[model samples]
Structures are given as structure tokens and as C-alpha cells.
Target: MNSSYDSLVDLFLKSLRAEKNASQNTVSAYANDLNQFFIFLQEHYRKKADGIELEVLSHYDIRSFLAYLHRAGYNKSSVARKLAALRKFYRFLNKEKLIANNPLFFINSPKKDKKLPRYLEEKQIEQLLALPDCSTPLGLRDRAMLETFYASGIRVSELVGLDLPQINLDLGYMVVYGKGAKERVVPLGSFAIEALQNYLRRGRPVLLATQNNDALFLNYKGVRISVRGVRLTVEKYVRRLADSLKISPHSLRHTFATHLMERGADLRVVQELLGHVSMATTQVYTHVTTSKMKEVYDKTHPRA
Candidate 1:
């Protein structure tokens, strides 16, 4: 009677934090979503969040919550994410023997809107890459980092997390640690290799400043470059040359994937390169390619 629901929720969240290695941000977001769901339950059952019983909650009850979110004008993607959080928490409850039946086991998740990622056109990418003045150490590092981004289509985290042993410039590939610390070998094109070589020889050493940082990319202080540092570096060049294009470092990542797919790269190959756990995630770039092809066809055809 003393808020058993709250106790179970705490146990589940603790599992996410300790066992699953979820970040505080992730745990907090999941916690907030569950809090919203419980508030809706409270409105229905007239009980505190911890007083709601497992036997009383049903799939229809969860569906009603989804409907409530929709009525409140929550976007489809947000609704879907909330449902995902529910699924995880309920699964945790079931695993802990707190629930006799998983109420949400068969519940269908809310459909999410299809969103195509934004990317730079090839010409625009070339312009952005050229904006970095390679004469200076910081500029050379930025240039190499950007070159590696486009060449591999790597997540900015993976790009910045790179270390000396992870890269094999001579072999034209590098091992990228991705989500959940999963490892994948991504090919680095010659342009990326050359840029990396230059930075290693000229830029990184100049910035090293007698510090023993093993991080492949370094800041002005000769320390590991933070994610913000990479984003700002890209933004500076992008704001200068491609002023009209409101893009982030991920735009270069998207451009890398879209360009490769447009040039007839295998979808699975692109998936591996991008470190996508699902081919469906990689398939979004195909949509971009198809759209581009249609645009080209519409513009160039003379038979109309």
C-alpha cells in the first residue's frame, strides 16, 4: 500500500543506470516519460503513481495514454518515443516478477513520421572542405577532422573519440567504436588519409605542446578535442562559405552517406560504413538519392 509502484519504478531505473550503462540524461528522459504516463493513470484511477496496480492497468489503458498525448498535440515521434520508454519499463517490471502479465506486451507503438536527414550537395561539401586554411595547425586539424567525417560518414562522437591505434591510415581504414561501444571498421578514402597524414605530421605535433594526449584530434591546449569543439569548428567554416546552409557537423555525415548511395554503393555496405545497427536506418539515405535522381530527371529531360 506504501507506493509499491514507486519502488518498482526505482528498481527498473536503477537497472538502466547500473546494469545497462545508460547515461543520466537517458535515464532522466525515460523517468520523465514514465512520470507522465503515471500522472494520466492517477487521473483515471484517482491514486498516486506508486499506488497504481499492475493488474488494473491494461493495454487499452496504455492506448488511452497515447490518445491523451495525441490530444495534447504531442508529435508522432514524441508519442512513439514515450511508448518506447513504456515498453522498456514494463519489460523490466515483467522480468522482476512484479507483474503477472505484461499489459503492454502486444500494444502497437505509435507510428512515427518519416524524416529525411538534411545533407550538403557534393559541390557544397567541396566548398565547405576547402574553407579551412591548412597553413595553421588548428586549421589543418579542422580540415583533417572534416575530411574524415565526409569520408567515413561517421557520427561526430565516433570521429572525435578516435585515437592513434584505432586508425590505420596506410591501410585506408579505422575501427570506429559506435553505440553501446560496438566496434566497426570504416574505410577512409585517400583524401581522408592524406588529410589525416598531414595533420598527424604538421598540425597535431604543433598542437601537442609536450602533452601526452593520445586523442587523434587535439584542441589548442593540446588536449582531447571535445564534441563542442568539433561542432564549432565545422560551424565556423559553414557559416562563412555556405552561409545559406544552416547545417551542423552531422550534415557532413549525412552528405557522406547520401553521396555514396547515389553513386551506387551497396545499401548494406553503406550500413556498415555508417555503423547503423539496422539497414532501415541506412535506407533513409536511399530516399535522398531517389529524390535527387528525380530532381535531376525533372530538370534535364527534354521530351516534356
Candidate 2:
């Protein structure tokens, strides 16, 4: 009987490469998920990972792995993705006749509640953007950062990773490399263009004194700004605007998407601008607008 789990893992990886044609990122994700699962199985079943029989894995083992993930502070999304990988692996094993049955076939995934993302109101967004004083070089840079965030709706990672050559200030657009290193060009608003022009003229030169070259936004230390630094800068300005509205850099992204949808923008256009792989992901903003409309209707209707 083939009892070596390591051999099965090797075969599975080979199959993924040859038959599944999985990308490098997909292969890496599967490897990590399986390694974590193997560790959990070893601890729970009191057997070494390489020595454990494939058939020894039961539905209880799967449940235990999920429980361990939850206890270790993983969020629902992470847990769900891990479980999905396990399910796919087990299904493959069963199909190959290596396992008698798939344990995860009967197991249900954890119910993940879809929480509507928090976003800023239009007036609050304006207030936050205006909060940055543009007289000083740092202030000009901050203003440009704030405007670019709202105008492009790019992720903080994408924003921090921006390069000078990727931006076309005269054309009012910038190219962003998003998740999976996929590149897309997004248009900037007039406000962002103006702020960026001011920063390039006044702020970037001072920042460039110590460091030379192609990064778009820089920190006080003359290096490219980090995601954490951008988040802190955003939080600082948000705090200055209003005490009640809790805001983060991502709130600006949500506001940009939501406001565009509310203003009759094409969902496909918004999806492309947000660099969403699926239009389904961008459609959530419409639900947010619909919920707001219901709130206003309930408040004004005179029915008993």
C-alpha cells in the first residue's frame, strides 16, 4: 500500500504543474496551504507527516484544521481559502483512486458574513483632502497623495509601489501594477492632476535632494513611501477632519467606487478603474448605494 504522504504530495505537485497548468503563484499558495495542513495533521493524529497514511485523514481532521486556524487568529477569508485548497486536493486524490473517499466532500465551508466596507461621505472626502496644507513641501506631497488616492481608487500597495515613469501627468492617467503583477492604466481627476503638478514643482525637488530617480511619492527620509506611512498620513488628515467618521486609506477607495456608481457610472468602467478582476466584485458598491436609498425612503415616507 502507498502510505508515504510525502510521495503523494510530490505526485500532487507534479500533477498540478502538468495537468492543472497552475501558475507559480497558485502553486506557491497550494504548497503553503498543504504544509500548514500537514503540520496540523501531524499534531492531531500523533503521526509524522511523511509517515501518515493518506486514508488516516478523516472529516474530523479537516474540522480540527479549521478550528486551529480560527484559534490562531486567521480571518474568515484566509480560513475559507485554505479549506478550498484542501477540498481541491482531496477531490483530486479520490479521483486518482489514492484515497477511498474524499473527507471534505461532505464538509461544509464556514459561513462568511459579507460586511459592507466603510466609506467616506462626499463632503467628508472633500474635507479630508482640504485638510492638507499645501504651503510646505511635505504638505504639497500629502495633498498629491490624498488626491491621487481618491482620483484613481488604487490599492495602498499599488499607490506605494508607483513609479515616476508609470505616471502620465499631461494625459491625466497613471499605469498601476495590481495583484498578480497585472498592469492597468487608470485615469486621474483634475484635482489629482493639479496637486501632483504642485508636488512635482515644489515638493519632489526637495525630497530628491538626497535620493535620485524614478519613484513617484517619497517619504521625509528620501525613500519611496511605504504602505504604512501612507496609511498613517491618511489617518492623520482624517483625524483632523471629523471625530465621528472613522476613516482609513481604504475608505477613500470605497468612497471613490461608491460615489462613481451612485453618479451613474458604468459598472464595467468602474471595475476597470478599480482594477478588479471581476465585475462581480465592483457590483457590491451598487448594493451600498441601494441601502442608502432605502434609508432615505424610510426616513421620509409618511406611512403608519
Candidate 3:
């Protein structure tokens, strides 16, 4: 391509890599989005736009780009992500004084509906955990996995990425690496600790074919378990429970947070345990718990 375009791409990528410390997946996503933006500009403007000079693009251009995406049959979520990438890029440019204003600041993003997360009741959680028969080696591993998910309230991504060294069995705590590579230590409940101990002693070694010693949880094939595998295993156990309580692995996370709040755990502490970047995100669990309490009060009170 043109030297100016090449230089801008390189500069932006270097900023993301060196300054932002973006993960490989994040960098790849940004590159893909920006590349699409460049192609759209080339086709619409009829002149090949290049470099940081293109960073001076107007709200009109951005609107047209978004319109083009919609017309090209892109889903709302994909369109939203593309707009987000553009906004981030423009903010970076404005921060560096490469632009007088952010065009994205003027353009309105499409509204996205908030979908409430599904969560299990305390009884359902108990039933699901008990569903795993700890008599067999695989059963012990599955039991430990489910217990850890509920006890720690960790994301499936964080859970699957856990290493053996991160667990402090004696102390009943585990360190989780979350988004942006931020690390937080979360306490494991007694049940999770017991399950993990059983897995470590009787189950994990049976799964290991070689000295694959890094992962905290492993599949039957002795490899580090994947996020999908974890989800599937959780699904399998949830299905064993009544069909009324259909749940995913993330549901366990929600249940963990909500149950903690219902039990009067501090909001900030729950935020820290969940590794939420903002307490506001963690505060939603309080609302969920409150709604349940209100339902109970309405049902029991007879002051008609």
C-alpha cells in the first residue's frame, strides 16, 4: 500500500502493542476491524486514503461506514464492535494530538439491548454439585471443576487458564488472571477445597500421561482442558438436574456472585473476588438479590 497508510498502521499497531499492552487476540481483532474500515474508505471516497491523515475523518464518513456495514448484512453485535474499535482508535488519536476532535464522539452508536444473565438458585447449585459422583477419577475431576467455578465466581476463561501453581490448597485460595491480565486472589470454599484435594490425590494423576504439570484441570486425554470443554462438562452435570434449571458455566458464576450478595457479602469484596474492573458491574448482583428478597417478602406478608 501507500507509505503513509503503511506508516499509520505500523504506528497504531506499535501503540497498541507497546503502550496498551494488548493481548494477541485483541491486536488481531483491532487489525481486522481497521483493515475493513480502510477498505470501506477506499471504496466510498474513490481516492485512496492513507496514514494518520485519514484519522481526520468526519462523522459523515463514520456514519456512512456503519451504514455500509448494516447494508452488507453485518449483525448488530458485529456493527457495534466495529464502531467500538473506531471509537477507541479515534480516542487514541485525539489523546496523541493527532486529531483536533474525535469524529466518533459526534456519531451515535447503535443501542444494544441488555440481556440479563441466567443464574441458578442455591438449591439448584447444591443439586448440580452433588450430581458429580466423586467415586470415580473423572467424577472427582468434574466435581472439583464445578466446585471451583461456583466457589471462586471466576470467568470460564480465567478458570481454564488456571495453573497448578496458582492454587493454595492449604489456604483455600487461588489466584486468577482476568481481563487485561489483571490478577486477583479469590478464596475457595471448603467444598471446593475438599473436591480439589481429592482430584489432586486420586484423579489428576490418572489423567496425566506424561509430565504435563502446568494446568490445574485436565481433560480425560491428559491435556489442559479448554473453555469449551469446561462448558460442556458443566452442561452435562446441569442436564442431570431437572430440565427446569437449564444452566451454563457462566450461570454458576452469576449464582456465586448473587448468592454471596444475598448472604450479605460486601459489594466491594465481591467486586474484588469477581475481578470486575468496576464495582458498578458487581453491584448488579445486589439488585438481583434484592429482587428475590422483595419477591419473598411479597409472598409471605399478609397485610392486605
Q: Give the winner by TM-score.
A: 1
lDDT of 1 by residue, 155-220 (tens): 889888999999998899999999999999999899999999999999999999665678999999
Of 1 and 3, which scores higher on TM-score? 1
Candidate 3 lDDT, tens digit per residue, 1-304?
A: 4567656666777899998899999988988898888888777886466645475677888899999999999988899999988888777766777666677877877876555668988887888899888888889999999899889999999989999999999998999899999988999999999999999999998898679468988998898999899988988887779766668888889989888888989998899989988887787787788888999899999972
What lDDT does model 1 reach? 0.86
Question: Model 2 lDDT vs. the true structure?
Answer: 0.86
Clash pairs of candidate 3?
none
Candidate 1 error regions (>4 Å): 1-54, 84-102, 165-171, 175-185
Q: How would the candidate models be sorted by TM-score, starting from the highest? A: 1, 2, 3
Model 2: what TM-score?
0.70
| Residue 92 C-alpha lDDT in model 3 | 73
Q: What RMSD does each model have against the real structure?
A: 4.2, 6.5, 6.2
> What TM-score, computed on C-alpha atoms, does each candidate reach?
0.76, 0.70, 0.68
Looking at candidate 1, the ten consecutive residues that score lowest on lDDT are 47-56
Q: What lDDT score is found at residue 105 in candidate 1? A: 76
TM-score of 3: 0.68
- lDDT (Cα, tens digit) per residue for candidate 2, span 1-304: 1247767777787889999899989988987898888877767766564533557666777888888999999998899899998888877787788877667866888878778989988887888889888898889999999999999999999999998899999999999999999999999999999999999999988887465568889999777999999989998887788777778888889999999987888889999999999877888888898988788789999981
